[model samples]
Target: MRIVGDGTRALNFFIDTLLVFLLAYAGFKTWNFYVMYWGYPAYNFGWFFFGILFVYYTFFELVFGRTPAKWFTYSKVVTAKGSRPALWQILVRSLVRLTIVDMFFIPFFGKPLHDKLSGTVLIEI
Candidate 1:
């Protein structure tokens, strides 16, 4: 198993972000229609978008060991020893990924805070 480099991880993040954005857009349109027709007040879209991202990353990673972006990039989340990570590890990784430091430090460090803390790594299959 080859460790995925910074470039591939960055690309995976970009693709995942784009996918989340598209999903948020669809959700926003639907919510907008409901608000317009039902006369409900507009809710905070930022929170909704964040929730979508959290669910997307956590659920997919837990279920498949990778998100859609990771799948396309031929990368996967694995334990430091190159085995499939446990559920708790995946959860920790996903939650840690939401932090600001993880976002900023990942590109330069090649491993995000999430991966380090969870004892997991991203590997190119």
Candidate 2:
């Protein structure tokens, strides 16, 4: 196994972000349709989007150790010793994904801040 390169990791992030955006868009449109039909005020989608993303990442990582993007990229999350990360580690990794700085550091440092904080790394399979 090898640690995935920065470029591959960035691409994975882009793909995941796109997926999340698509899901959020669908949710927003559905909610708006219902709101209009019921004559209720339109609700902001930002929180809903974030909540979906949080659950999406956390759930997938905990169960699969990777997201769809990672699967497509042939990469997966693992502990420092190269074993599957524990549930708590997966949770930490997922939660830290919400921090913008974690992703921003990836281009410059090769690894994201969340990986360090969670004691996990992205490995090419």
Cα lDDT of all candidates, in order? 0.85, 0.85
lDDT per residue as tens, model 2, 16-89: 98999889889989889989898767879886677778888888888898999999999999899999899888
What is the Å distance of residue 39 in model 2 from its true position?
4.9
Question: Lowest-scoring 10 consecutive residues by lDDT in candidate 2?
Answer: 102-111
Query: Any runs in candidate 2 off by more than 4 Å, and if so which?
Result: 39-41, 107-110
RMSD of 1: 1.8
Clashes of each: 0, 0
Looking at model 2, residue 112 earns an lDDT score of 88
The most accurate candidate by lDDT is 2
Give the per-residue Cα lDDT of candidate 2 at 94: 73
lDDT of 1 by residue, 24-115 (tens): 88898889898999987787778667778888988998889899999899999889898888888987877886777886766676678888
Off by over 4 Å in 1: 107-110
